[model samples]
Every structure is written in structure tokens, then in C-alpha cells.
Target: MTQTLVKAPFRADQVGSLLRPESLKKAKNEYKAGKITAEQLHEVERQEIKRAVDKQIEAGLQVVTEGEFGRDWWHSTFMEHLLGAEGYIPEQGYNFSNQETDPYDVRLVDKVAYNPNHPFFQQAKELVEIVGDRAVVKFTIPSPNQFFHPNIINGQYKDFEEFAPDIIQAYKETIHEFYRIGIRYLQLDDVYLAVIATADFPPEEKKYLAELAVRVVNGVLEGKPEDLTVTTHVCRGNYRSDYSFSGGYDTVAPIVFANEKVDGFFLEYDDERSGSFEPLKYIPKGGPRVVLGLVTSKTGQLEDKEAIKARVQEATKYVPLEQLCLSPQCGFASTHHGNILTEEEQWEKLRFVVETANEIWE
Candidate 1:
């Protein structure tokens, strides 16, 4: 049997809106309705974030985040006040077809006028300072490409090709900005890349998009300190308790593999909807660590360890087994409503990931 490595289990994002407890939201509403100032809103978030960081450490996790404590969901919802993205309100998102929640609307903001001091980055800086040296402080940001992607709010693009350069510049600026802030781990949350990549596109078109994505992503990452570790998390789509785009690595493979800058990849492989492991061949062996999102945070059920091990083996045929890691497919909650699973069930799933990883890799 191939030897496996047991690394600590980590979450892409902890359901922040859920973690803060019901009292916090009530405070937020009271403040919004003429009871509190922005400072109060932030104070509550700060208190909860501290609690969140402590709990993560207790979870037997080494790479802990503030559970994205200040963020409502993913990196998008946090953009409401700054970017003017409509995510602050509850609306029907592109994913979760029939479901609705107090969600933000699609974003149309461009990279040209983007501001770095937005609340998202501002509070993130504070969180890093507070969590100092406790755990790897990670900031998850939306890829610039989301602005031009079809279906998002203000995504006026009829053709994505022309939008490439500005997108690159925007993302490049973002990475540099984050690095300057003393942040080391930047998790680029990309959802559209998984959905739009399809077999129908001509090879040239596919290659062009791939090149653009890799180029812009890497461009933003250029000149970073060697000590930094960049991770990219590819999501099919996680919205108000719903799925968005669905496909496999076959379409984006090798294209995804083409980029070698990111130190780790938190990829979705929780179900067959992600496609077979065959496309994994494209990833350059031993390039970056691969965090196989085998344990799902979407539902209450636990995955079988035996099956997970087999999948890891199958994947090893492409990338080195030593280069692999484990995690949940995506955030337990990309939105405030969170998934259908209870907190206990979520922990059990995470327990399964760590335990299964230990048994296989050790």
C-alpha cells in the first residue's frame, strides 16, 4: 500500500453567520434600524471572531481561519458595503435554483476602480494581527474574473475574452496588496472557472481562457515573498444552501495544472459531479500540494474512509501521494443560512477527514 500523510483537517470557510450566534444578528439589525453605529457592528464581529479563532484551535486543526468570522459568506458577501455589490440583501443567487435567502446580488465592480481599504481587507488585517502566530491566517478573496463572468450582477460581458487584461491587472493588484499587508496565505476562491470550462469550446478558446486565468492569477502573485503560500479553491458553486455550476477537471485540467505558482489547491472532489480523476494527470507532479476536498461540508452524511483512500490512490497515479492533503469540498456555508447539516454533524464529517487521512497516509 502507498504510504499516506496525515495532515490536520481545515475548513475552506466556517459558516460565519451561523457561528456568531443569533444574538449578534439581532444586534446588527438593531444597529441598522437606528440603534448602533458601524463601530458597534464591528465590535460584535470582533468579539465573535476571537471566539471563532479559539474554537478552531480547539478543533484539533492547525491551519485555522477566523471561520471567516467577519465575512457573511465566502468573500463575496463581505463586499457589500465597499464594492456596492448587492450581496447585502436576500436574493435568488445564480446557484440554488429554487432557494432564496438574504443574499447579495451579483457584482459588476471592475478592477480599475477597486479599493483596497474596503471593509473586507480592513477587518482581515485586524484579524491577522489578533490571531498572530496562532494559526496560518488566510484571507479568501473573489477572483477578478467574477466581474465579467456571465450570470453575476452587472456581469455585462457578452464575451469573456476581451475582459482578460483588466481582470489580470485587478487580481494582480489584489495579491500584491494582500502581501503588503503581512498576510501570507491568500486563498483565491474561484467558482466560475469550474462552471464555464466546458468541452464545447474550441481548443484555442479553451487554451486562451486557461492562459488568461493562469496569467492574471500569477500576475497578481508576482514579486511575492518566497515565504508566502498561495492556495486556490475551485468551487462548483455554493450559495444559499444550493449548488451552482457542475463539471469535472477534464475540462479545466492541465489548464489548471499549467499554473504552478499556487502552493496548494483546495479542489472539489466530494462527488462524481466533479468528474473522474483522469484529468488530474495535467497537474505537474510535486508542483503544489493538493488538498482533495473529499469530505463534504454540504450535508449531514459522512463519507466512507475506504472509498476516500481508493480515490487518493487513483489520484496518486497522477500527482505524488505525498503532495496530497484533505479538506471539505467547500465552505460549510457559502452563505449565512449555512448547509442543512448541524454543527455536530459538521464536526463529525471533519473528524472523518482527519481520521481517514491518518489511517490511509500513515
Candidate 2:
């Protein structure tokens, strides 16, 4: 495997999706209400994305994303755009802490394929053009395993065996298209695998689920460009500052650490809910690195520099310091509604990650 030497998934990084500015938020709402033209919405998105990219650079981040401002939520937005999929706003919503979200869900209306003119591809292209070598432009998408959830998969295929190949091919084609468009850094935001890891099930069942997740991910990564830095972010589900699952990497570590073919693992470890660093021992001495998320995005309060340092030191006990990096537990805004913090607070948290990373890795 050839390593891509980009300053991303670096000693300092994030899980993409930043809080949408008020202007962008308003424009999105207006477009939804049919008050604004698609052309008008596109113009606003372009300007806002440019500003978001500039903010990443200003904050001392070497890697940047479009901040996912073009979409309302992470997973469904991308899924709905797939060639064979159609989305719907359900009457009810999923629960998370004190909140419930009226999420849009996707169903396969036909066989899936990459639509070259998909809005996300166009948006990613624009992001690459705007960054213009100023920083490494990163694009994030939901992992293929994510679509395997019963909510998405049940009606589409007879079983995993039947569904896997089509989705895997779609993702492979998508990755190749992304590479063709000058995208060298890509992150797969996969919250489902982490959720599966935390579930209480028969040992055999857990192992089976874990293995299937790894299989689909590795399949999606098949034949990827050696110079492309493909990483997976295992989210425990971040919506309105609440999580859907909680557990250590222990259950899935052995499977993912040993089996998955990727460049790095962006593992969440911001609080006690995620459990211990013991699973890091499964990581091989070399190859994929670990980007530890010790900072919190759920709240705006700055973490003590000394405390974070202590955690980094503790993590070094499992994985060598050279193979480690830092980030917030998750994105500040996994959805466009934004997290429960002020914009200034969001920047402060990210800036702190940069400052803390510099102190340790400098």
C-alpha cells in the first residue's frame, strides 16, 4: 500500500460538518419552502462554502471540507442522491436525548450507481477548485455499511448476500469518480459500525455483524488509488448533541484493526461513554494510524490543556505517539441544524484542538 502524505487526518483534524451560518441556514429553509429559486440557493451555498473553507484555513487546520453545508443531514442527503434511491420525510422521527428528528429516509427505487452530475460531486468539485492548493480538500460520505440498516435495506434485497454486491459496486464507482475529479483525501463517516460494536448480542452474532461491516468497507475500498488517503470515522451517532450508542472499540477493534484496508481510523474517544483506550492495542505497529478524538464537540467549554495532555499520554501507552493524532469527539454540526453551541464556541473548540496538537506534536 502506498501512503498519501497529506497534512490531513493529521495530528489535528475533524470529522467534517461545521455549524451552518445563519445566511446559509436561511437560504436552505427558503429553498425548502419554495421561496427561493434553485439558482439562488446554489449561489448562497457557493459563497457559504467558500467562507467555511476559509475559516478552516484561518483556524490553522491543514485539511478542510465543504463543511457539509450543502445538505440538511449527513447520511440521507448523500443516500438520496444515489441513482436508484428516492427519499421521504417520515411522519415520525428518531429519538435522541431530549430531541426527536424528522429525518428523511431513502429507499431503493432502482439499482444504485454514481450519478456523475450529482449535486454532491458538483459541490465537492467546487470545494476543490476554491481551496486551490491552499489546503488539502477533504470530502466525507456515509459508508456503504451504513445503508445496510434494516430501515434502508430490508425492502431492497433478499438478504445481505444479495444487497452487498450492488452497494459495494456503487461505492467503488463513486470513489473512482471522486479520484477522477482531483479528490485525494476522503473520509467515510460510518456511525452504524460503531453502533453495532456497542450492541449487546450473542458473541457469534456480534462477530458476524462486525465481519460484514468490515467486508463491505474493504469492498468499497477495493482498487482505490494508493495516493488517496481513505479513512473511516466511527461515530456513535451525533444528532442534536446526543449520541445513539456508547461502548469502547473493544468489540469491533480486532475485526477492524486487523481486517479493514484503509489508511487511518478516526475513532471517537471524547468521554467516558466511549470507554477505554485498551482496544488501541489491537492496532498493528505500522500502516493505518489512529486519530484520537479527545476534545468534545457536544459542549463549548474549553478542555484544560493539561488534562488533554494527560489523556494523550495515556493513549500513548497503547499506540505509539507517532501513530496518534487528535480531533473533537465528532463534528460540531453533524446536521445542518448545528450543534447546541454558539459559532464562536465551535471555533474555540477546534482552535483548541489545533493548539493542543501543536503543543504535543510540535
Candidate 3:
């Protein structure tokens, strides 16, 4: 039987979030210090995001993000905006590969539910209006599992199962709201699942954790709109270009690829740490498309186009070439501080992805 090809937003896409420009950074700091009003900060963001969107179009990407300028951190911004959540600083940092993150977390203070006026939703609306016909827009949020990170203690529930239902409901409502407001593309940036995937747990323990991750995500995705294109971006970790985990998708592929009801996947494959493309075999002949993260956002070094194409060809051994696309291994700026690369360098990397995809897939 012939396998039908999976259509995606673009042959060349990104994992969302671009490096924050100096102007946006300054405005954010000003707003935080009360030196500028919210209106003033938003004005800056509006202008900066316009520029970012233009840059993405110029790089030949069909789908672009607002660069997540309104966010201080990837997950914290959206989580903190939840109606029942509150933010707090912790005593220790989230240890990563060779570095540690500053302490920050969002706790459940009330019953979990969606906030009608989520700032991220408003930002997505602005981006689509600004982008017009130039390109499609995607808004990314950390997964619901992020709220239950072990480091975070729930203030309202004694156990995760006690509140998983509310969490699922809140996310479902949130997704529906985005669709109602005209958002067709949404990406959930999740490191928790990847962390579980890479951890060296016993076989049974690992499968159990992976299954739990899938259940929570699928719960959030339950009854999603058909027109909505939802995808998940898995990363080992990305904080100021530092990572927390390593290993391949082999362990979690069966759990995620077969269970989670996402339209596609943005997978990390930039370095040796991510293992091989062998696990692509488990993707099921005609399931979700896979976006190869052959380009790295952690550094400014440009990858050879021929090398990237060759790697994509290698991946085709498991999954058909038509089922594959290309993107950066992760966002250039998972946090507002941005990665270790310069803005120009980041643009170069994106341009490379575009050029490589054009040469291979177009």
C-alpha cells in the first residue's frame, strides 16, 4: 500500500521564539522597574514583533512566531497567567547540562482554569493581524505537565492526580479559546517529557513515566478542533544555550508517537547527544510528520547545507522523506535573555534552514 504524505505548515519551520532584540529587552526591563507604563512596553513589543515577523518572512519561513517578546521565560509567562496560578522564586536553580537556571516557578493557588484574557492569546491575535497574508502565525506554550514539575509544590492539591482533571480542563479550554480567536497553529514546548525520555530509569519505570506524559498531553488535546494544527517541540533543555539532559527519542517514541495526538513533532537532533534517527521507524507509517532539528540554535556556527540534506536523507531510512521537514533543534531564545548567539547569527541559522529545505524538499 502507498503511504500518503503528511502536509505541514512549511517545509522549513522553526521551534518558535527568536532572540529578543535590544529594544524589546530594554522596554521589558523598564516595565518591570515601573520606569515605563504597560502601554509603553506594549508599544515597544508591537514594533519589535513587526520587525521580527518581517525578518522571518525575509528568511523564507511560511510560519513565524512573535519571537515570544512578551515573555520573560518560556513556560513561566503562560503558566503565571493562568487564573489559578501564582509565581514565586525558589532557593535553588534548575540545574542544566553545564549550567543552572535562576529559581522561578508557578504554583496552583486556586482551582485550575483558563484565564479568558490570556496575554499570550492577545499577543497571537496581534501577530496574525500584523502578519496578514505574509505568513502563518504559531503561539507556543509550555505543556500542562510543566505546572507539576517536582520542584514546584502545589498549594491547592496534595497530589497531582487530585488536580490533573482541572489541569486538563484548563488546557482544553485554553486551546479552544485560541481556535475561537482564529489561531490555527499552536505548538506546545515541552522539556519535561524529553527529560523523562532521556532519564536512566528502570525499563518499567521509564515506560510508566513516558505513558504518564502522553496521557496528560493527550488529555489537553482531547476533542481539539480539526482545523487547528497542533505540534509538540521536544528538547533536552535550552537555557542560555545550556542543556539539562541528553540521549535519543528511542525510549519515548512508542509512548509519544503512538499516543499523543499532535499533528507533528519538532525533534532535537543537532548534536551527538540526541542519538540517531533509528527511532524514526516507530513513527507508524502514516502518523504525525517529523520536523528534523538538524540546525542548532545553541551556537552561531552555520551548518553545511549538503551535510543537513545528507542527514535528512539518513532519517528517510526510517520515515519517508515526505514525512520529514526541517527546523532548528530548538528556539533561539527559550527565555527572554536569549541564547549565546548574536541576533545576526540567529537570522543566519534560520536562513540556512530555509535554503537547505528549499534545496531538498522544494
Candidate 4:
């Protein structure tokens, strides 16, 4: 009894960012070295994005993204583009499982506000023009909760109470701006929720953080247009195939599943670090549809088709099959560095999701 969704969170969706093609990577480096102009770099991005969209459709995906090809880091690019936020080289980079990332982070210099002229607006316009009507165009941004990261230097606001509303207003305005354009599918890529979910904290402290996470998310989502298919992709961190946190969703599931005001959830469940599906029971009937990230994007290895199907069947114990969809654990490239997998392998993985989903849901 699979229910067909005309909106997004498609049966076979993706977590947005894709592997950066070598040409675009080279162009980025050339621009950095002043060998190529910004205009030239953008032209290459446009070309690569077109090719990426075509491949996504060719792989049988109904939704297409620009592959987050226009920037260096997935979250920082969008965040720094805000009116009052700026990028800075931190003392250190984020610590992933066995490695450290490049030192890049965002900081607020003044009161944060949405910029109508943000580069993302132009990026979304180009994406819609390139995608045409063949597939839905999905635009992704970091969640407001992401701003609460300890690394992000906050210079304007004093406390959560003073800070939360402005972030909420900024996000609400940004969403409306996207809606004004042709984007109907918008996703907030959230790693903070997962960070708090698995962080070592006392029971009461964890509960407070989880509740605060929901409030920030819902505040940003308040009064969003009905036509916008807003979803949140929860990740435990996806950088160079390295992860940041590990633990079950057992503690935060009840809070997130029952409250976050979103159309669906792109949840990471590719490995044991994500824990069991028992927490999915907290998802009330008729609430957000769960797009299961059962396929791993960390490596080039393709999972057994039957094993993925079996995992989906296992998830059905808590959530009905009709309420479930499929995707990779995270994007192939959450950062411009991309993952350690070949481009061909990324497509192969996506094709597997489409093919496997067809068998189970179609």
C-alpha cells in the first residue's frame, strides 16, 4: 500500500550536494588563484549544474538540485551570504571521525537579516530555468539551529531569547523569497539536531537542547506557504566520508518527530551508528513522511538491493510502508571537498535507490 506523492520527498530522493566534477573544481582553484574571473567560474558552475541535473533525471530521480556546486562548504556559503553574517578562518576546522576539515566557519557581525539579493536567489533561478518542467527543483540551506554551533562567533545577540526571533524572521523571509521564485521544494540541511541528539549530556540537559532545537526549527517554519514542500535532512555529519557524532536517535526522537513543523524528514539511517527504527514509532500517523536514508553515500560500494529492501521492511514495523521513502544517508558532497567516491559510483548508488524503490513502492 504505497502512497504516491505528487509533491517532494519523492520515493527516491537525494540529500542535495553531489560530487564536484573535476572541471568545476579546477575552475574554483583557478578563480582562487586569479587565473579565471568570477564570471568565468560561474559559467563553469552553470554548465556542471546542467549536466548534474540531466544525470539525476537520467538516473530516474524526480527531483533535481544544483548539487550545491556554487560554493565551498554546504552550510557556510548560504550562511555567510546573509546580510549580517561573514565567513572567517577559524582557529581550527571541524573534527570528523579520523580527520579535520579546513578552517571555515561563519560569524554574525550585526543583526542578521535575509538578503533578497542573496546569491542563492540567482542560483535557484538558474536551476529552475535549467530544470524546466522535467523535474522538481529543490533548494537547500542550513537550519537555523545550525547557527547555534559553538564555533559560530555570535557578536550581535546576547542570549537565545534575543537571538532566536531574528533567525526565525530571517529564515521565514528567505523561504518566502524562494517561493516567489519557482522553487516549491525547499530542504533545511540540519546537522545540529543530530549533534545534540548524540552529544554526551545529562538527561535533563539533553531534553532542554532537544526542545530548543524543535523551537528554533518550528519558529523558522512558522506561517510558511502551503505550497512549499519544506523538509529537514538530519545528518550526523558527512565530510570526506567521515562522521562527527554517533549514537541512537532514541533520546531526541520523541521531541523531533512529534514537533518539528516540516513536510518530511531526510533522516540518516545508513549504518548502526543511527540506531534502530524503533524510535520512528513516535512519528504520529498523517505527520511528516519519513524518507529513510538506508543507502550509504560515504563509500563507493553499492549495497545489496535485497538488503536495502529488507531494511525498508524492518522500518515498516514502526512506520507504515506508505509513509516511507528512500535516499542516501547524506549528500555525496556536503562540502566542496566531496566524498572519497568516484562520480560513476555516486550515480550507481542513486540508480540503485530508484531501482530498489520501484520494486518496493511502485
The C-alpha lDDT values of all candidates are 0.65, 0.85, 0.85, 0.90
TM-score of 1: 0.84
| Number of backbone clashes in candidate 2 | 0
Better of 3 and 4 by lDDT: 4
Best by TM-score: 4
Tens digit of per-residue lDDT, candidate 2, span 156-237: 6777778888889989989998988889999999987887788888989889888998999999888898889999999987
> Relative to the unseen true structure, what is the Cα RMSD of model 1?
4.0
Please list all clashing residue pairs in model 3, or write none if there are none: 97-243
Listed in order, each prediction's TM-score against the native is 0.84, 0.96, 0.95, 0.98
How far off is residue 350 in model 2, in Å? 1.4
Off by over 4 Å in 4: 1-3
Which candidate has the top score in lDDT?
Answer: 4
Which pairs, if any, clash in model 1? 4-361, 5-361, 86-105, 87-104, 87-105, 90-102, 90-103, 106-153, 172-220
Lowest lDDT 10-mer window, candidate 3? Answer: 1-10
Compared with the true structure, what per-residue lDDT tens digits does model 3 show for residues 1-362? 11122335467889988999998888888889999999999999999999999999888788888988888889988998888888889787689878778888777778878898888888888988999877778888898878765445465877767777888999999999888878888998888878788888899978877787788889998899887998988878889999888888888887888778888988999999999998878787777889999999999999988999999999999998877889999999888878999999999999888888888876
Scored against the true structure, residue 156 in model 3 reaches a CA lDDT of 81
